[model samples]
Target: MRFDLFHTRVDAHIRKAQEYLQAANLARIEHQIAADHHLALASMYAQRVTWLEQELSESVSRFSPPFRGVMTVAAEGGKRGAESVVSLQRSAPVSNG
Candidate 1:
């Protein structure tokens, strides 16, 4: 699924969870059974939101490129020289042959 759509669905679930919680709170004063049902629905939505967030995080990390370094430009004698200013170590294990 597309990231935007996934994000929108997550947001919708969050709103549903919030609405259910509000309903549960309101129902708690008059009907305990109704309150319990709403609470259960809220919990289900909350769990789904948690799962979706974790999935989104993992998906982003999986697709993101590893940061290697930053390039900086220096001027000397009217000439531009490009140099890597910051270098980062690779996250993956390096193998020696």
Candidate 2:
């Protein structure tokens, strides 16, 4: 697939995932503020927020580097890290001078 299509799809996916992340945060706040508040409910939603964040990160890592410093490979680790670096290099624009 062309980089344009890939970028577009990835952007769309990230936007959708962001909505879920926001919902998770809202749930955490709501639970925290409720009269029957239980820390566990807020904690559960907080964990969901973390999971969604990682999901978004992994999704971004799959894309062509949109720009410099896309994903710090160290944050990814292992084979996936190597693959993202290769993908970023390959997708890097060729400069003419």
Candidate 3:
């Protein structure tokens, strides 16, 4: 189904976004100013935002049950992982602040 394809794309992008976001956060904490990390983060986010917005634009269409469940789980896991990293980063002290 078309929705399945879109869901799969979204899941793929989400996974990549999660990875890049993690790396960006790590680089930020490590004081790496290579800028590539920031660029990667921005690219990942752009892909994710585009995919999500497209999905939202077709919100009236329903996804298959299994695909819907998978997407939900994937998104939730991504959010939890990102949040954990963010929390850790916040609690970490700045050596040069």
Q: Which candidate has the top score in TM-score?
A: 1
RMSD of 3: 31.9
lDDT per residue for candidate 2 within 27-87, as digits (tens), equals 9888767835667688889999899878877877676564223455544453353435433
Candidate 3: worst 10 consecutive residues by lDDT? 80-89
Residue 70 of model 2, lDDT score: 43
Off by over 4 Å in 2: 1-36, 67-97
lDDT tens digits by residue: candidate 3, 1-97: 3456444576778999999999999979776666768988999999999999678546524764545544554556545333233211356666985
Candidate 1, residue 19: Cα displacement in angstroms equals 34
Task: At residue 16, give the lDDT of candidate 3.
Answer: 100
Full candidate order by lDDT, most accurate first: 2, 3, 1
TM-score of each: 0.35, 0.31, 0.29
**Best candidate per lDDT, number?**
2
The reply for model 3, stretches above 4 Å from the true place, is: 1-33, 61-97
